[model samples]
Target: MALISDNDPIYELLDKWHEDDEYEKILEKVDEIPMEERSNKLWFRKISALNNLKRYDEAREEIAKLSPRCTETADIGRLFYMMGYIYDQKNCEFKAIECYRRRAEIDPSWDECDEWVNDSLGYAKKDMDRAYNAFSRFFPDYAEKNQNAAEKKTVEEPDILPYISAMGSSFMSSNLGVKLPLDQPFFKCSEEDKPKVVSFLTDRMHITDLKSLQQDFGRNRLAPLTSNILHIIETGEEPPLDKLNAQQLTHYEASKLLLGKMKEFIPEGGLAAWDYSDMLAIARFMYSVDMLTNTEIMQTYLFANDECKRLFKSWEEFTHSLTIGAFYNAFTRDTSYNINQSAKFAINVGLFCMQTYPGIEWLGEIKE
Candidate 1:
């Protein structure tokens, strides 16, 4: 809405296309506008037409293309809502719920978004419960026994349980019940080769020093840069571009472009979740490389686990926050990053974990 004007003739044409069910004509009209010139309304119309025509893949492609271009909160929120609809139609219930949850966070007044989220969540819960019940039928006391144990385990070593979903995409790809493997060949190195394994794992996870990474979580290095960009988005007051060097200008512009979507989707405790996830991920790699002993690794996981429990209420909420953090991490580090692909990958990982590991308490319980 912030991006459209009633006087725009293209919108008038789009409305006529909608009325006549001329979805193809809507696409054609939208395509006629140059990419740079296309407004949010144009992108919305194009995606709507694609959806109506049952071209879900093309609709998703268009959504991915439009994601990075959105600058207004209303536009970003609507984009997520549209994405939710597409996923709902495709029967990807978890992904749809994730998108709807994001839309709700961005614009809480859109009460319908909350309804969609609850509906999808309700359906997902029934499916998961059915699966659990089927499994329990084979082992009559399994659910009751494990449910109690899981609750007790949560209070004792909260880190291990919470870190399961943070396993993210890697956990999804492995055999369901198996512990996630480290880089396989390196995982079996001789004691003399331990240093090589350590070096390799550290480089792979981009971890320079484990202790430093843990301590640096409190640092707000991006605060000033983010504040400047937020100011630009809120008030049309532009900072002098000529004063910034080439790299600074690039970061400034990229932050300006991404800040809107970031603010809309990044939930409460999102940044902390991201940091803790990274720490746990790196700790796993460290354990494999002999950089951390079993005791050290458990200590790391426990600390992160406690923080995550304090910050997020459930596995879905945690993963959603983690994805937002991943998006910010990707784009901020490399302006050319494909955030759309990153988001899809992250969501898929969360969905797989939820479906595969239904016994995990965090996945089952909906804590307030």
Candidate 2:
């Protein structure tokens, strides 16, 4: 009552508020408080509260008043942080981003704050809700960097002949019009196992020729499975499907990819494709396709260290062995890739080839 003094100069400012709307009165009382005092934090907090209360105009006015003082003080820095939080708390994500940016400009070390702000913007972009899930990989810079590494590595990989010399083909078809990729490794392995396969791919296989293979044979389909299933299979006598949380999803994805790749070679009604209902059939188709196109590869081939090349070469012969191998697994007994995961992997490679290379003849090959 004393602060709302009967003779204070700002007293009328409060009286005028008695007849104004209740929220407006509260906001006015908030205005009468001194900007510089022990209560500076309190003042800014009220301003943030006002902004959340939908008094954005009032909030801007308060910000304008503080911007000069807010030039570099830790107090001002904290106020901006609250301002950003207010925006985010209100679900005004862009406004939140703007606040975070403002804070970052005030202090670049505010990058920690920037991470979340950009993340919010990524989610709040709200343009493609159905594709919003894919936006989870919002680390766009990371993807670009990885892809650039892949391109450079593709170019540096060694020649194709030495590696192919190691690959087993029954009889030579000279002028082999077949197209095999020079860069993409053909062994059937999951991406988790890719690091282990990298030695083989770089030393003996090629990634650059991926584009060429798709040109000759067809394109690869991308059925991206989320979990890593390769480790379990290599260590266990039987393929371990149940150990993974996403085993079922990975299984289905492998099936989809295998089937999708086969569709490229056989099209919709092709007799050869129809013959392969089980994963083994699909796997064989992939191997046959690789054999047919082995000579046409265009990318640089890597000479695997003798041991690694030998392993990959032996892989080609026994690659067919894993079909009955995976089929015996409890999860794959009825599943498609059970017959031969390697063959299925080959088909996936074909799909990857197609997607990466873009087949000119593969137009309209995907089934409706």
Candidate 3:
């Protein structure tokens, strides 16, 4: 299907309609396009509008009509997902499970399908054993692949554990009179002790209230600066300095300076590794405060580990990236501060983590 570019006026209008909760307008606009001329994107938007408006019967009808026309796996998977969503909303657990499972079968990489299937099974009070047996029988290769991946992860857990300590140690060691037990692994703290550790770090970080912290962390304030720097790096074309005000120009210059230093140590991944590390730290903190679950924390850790290992060859490179990232973030917030002092402090934190932690070798391999 020849999809409409997002910049197309009609597409933007449709997006505006979606954002404004004008579902009826979306249906009307979609219908204005000849049925044969409509793209899969338009059809998906129409179906989404119907689903959002709680017109489940109409949504299912649209799905049924669209199903046979879907030649691409992505479109077919989406159709099944929409159908599953409609069934779930109507409390038809069995139908929802069937749709979700079909979606998963067609696109094994669609993790949400598996999540919906599990949710539907729970709602139906179906035995997980039976579900697993059925799944294994149909997708033996996929099942075995996942099993092998899980085994590989289990084997690598210990190697990754030390990195977690290194990641969190800068925050832990900053607090005076707060120390982790010397003999015990940092992550092996008792449930009762976990809150204490979190509390100490939160206090040190001056996070007195959850509401404020959540508001601050909800969006990356550095995104604009980061984007500008990345654009300059990729294209070798500078943005119009005259267009930026004094404050923005200052920030742009700082971003370039920090990015230059970052390139010295980080061979790849650039700001992405820093973003993942930030997420990892926040996820751990959130888990401690009951804002996130242990499962979510582990998922965040695994994802961060994968990306960081792919980007960096050794712990020193990762540390340098983190240090520059920290300095960039802080300097952007308060450019009045001495830049050299701030950079030194951030670098010292990374150095402290490497030196103070027992198993954190500076040149340790970031295992693949």
Candidate 4:
């Protein structure tokens, strides 16, 4: 058989085989690769295959050969640790302990072997629970709540569950190409501003490409002057604008000043936790660019289309507003990557809220 290297198509096929748990095919791919190009990763895969098939002796022999040859200290440490697991599984307690100690000595940070060392004789109920409930990391707080519920111990819940739930729901809707409910408080805009926000999003600012973005907002629209103003707003300091002549005020500067002026008209608490200029910047960026096409995706907006028209007041206008501006506030407020996973996270938040506040019917309306 002709020997192949890492660049060969066989690697992809081997990856597929590994994913499918086809241990035999994995060994076959390993065999096809030349010995010179067969890195420690491939060798580990081969050992893993042997162990999966219960060929303990063969696995040990291969590990023995590979151990001395491994140049990377990390590889040697992991290799010995895995070998320890194999021995432990085989009921060779002494041999497993020896391997575990050797691995620890080689790599001081490899504390995972301590689990085996502490419970070498057998795992306790706590260890079993930890292993079984490894997925608790996804919903850290809720997982704790669930554990408390199981223990019949009451756990104090958080107050901002509705906001978290809404955020999570919106996030999921974004990924699944589904639109969130438009009637949510996060999307509260006046009837007069509705048409303007919708038109700005669907027609004027519905940017799908770089060309359109640059065309609508010039390439240097977010100039240093705008940055200066943003810095002042952020730091609560007045900039020395009088030093600059009228001719020095560029379009970007004027736009930023207008944004600052617009802040004065915003209703009390309407722009809670966010300045008008900041929201304006977010809105401009979101409406003027499509995240899927942009190389650097800062935010992903959940767009509303005809399918979800019934959920809105003026279906067409509300649909566009929901797609364009409504989410700008929420996505900007949320520190999550996007609305999908955030929305999924809301499931736990909503549940936690319901448990804490038993009678609030509106809090449970996170789905709508």
lDDT of 1 by residue, 1-368 (tens): 14445468878888988999999999998787777677777788899999999999899899898888888888898998888788667654556666766776677777896688667655544543443333224222333444544333232344344344345325422422224343331233356655654555555444555575465444523334455566678798987887764345545554555555456444455455556655565555566556666677667766666666776765545655665555455545532333344444445544444444444445233234
RMSD of each: 14.1, 20.6, 23.7, 25.5
TM-score of each: 0.43, 0.25, 0.43, 0.31
lDDT of 4 by residue, 1-368 (tens): 43344466766877788789899988877877777777777788889888888888889888987887788888988787778778666654434555676777778888786677666434322322332233233234433454455334221122222222333344333433333242332333344544544454457546544354435344323223344555566577865665643223222232333234323222222222122122223333333223223332222122111112223322112212222222223322342112332223333333434354333211111123
Instruction: Sort all candidates by lDDT, best to worst.
Output: 1, 3, 4, 2
TM-score of 2: 0.25
Candidate 3, TM-score vs. the true structure? 0.43
Tens-digit per-residue lDDT, 111-154, candidate 3: 78657766765654432233223323433333233444422222
By TM-score, the candidates rank as 1, 3, 4, 2
Q: Which ten residues in a row have the lowest lDDT in candidate 4?
A: 300-309
Q: Predicted candidate 1: what Cα RMSD to the true structure?
A: 14.1
Candidate with top TM-score is 1
Per-structure clash totals for the candidates: 0, 25, 0, 7
Per-residue lDDT of 283 in model 4: 36
Task: List, residue by residue over 131-192, the lDDT tens digit for candidate 2.
Answer: 22222232233234344543332211233232222222211111232323334434333445
Candidate 3 backbone collisions, by pair:
none
Model 1 — TM-score against the truth? 0.43
Candidate 4 local lDDT, residue 246: 25
List where candidate 1 sits over 4 angstroms from the true fold.
1-156, 159-196, 202-242, 357-368
lDDT of each: 0.58, 0.36, 0.58, 0.44
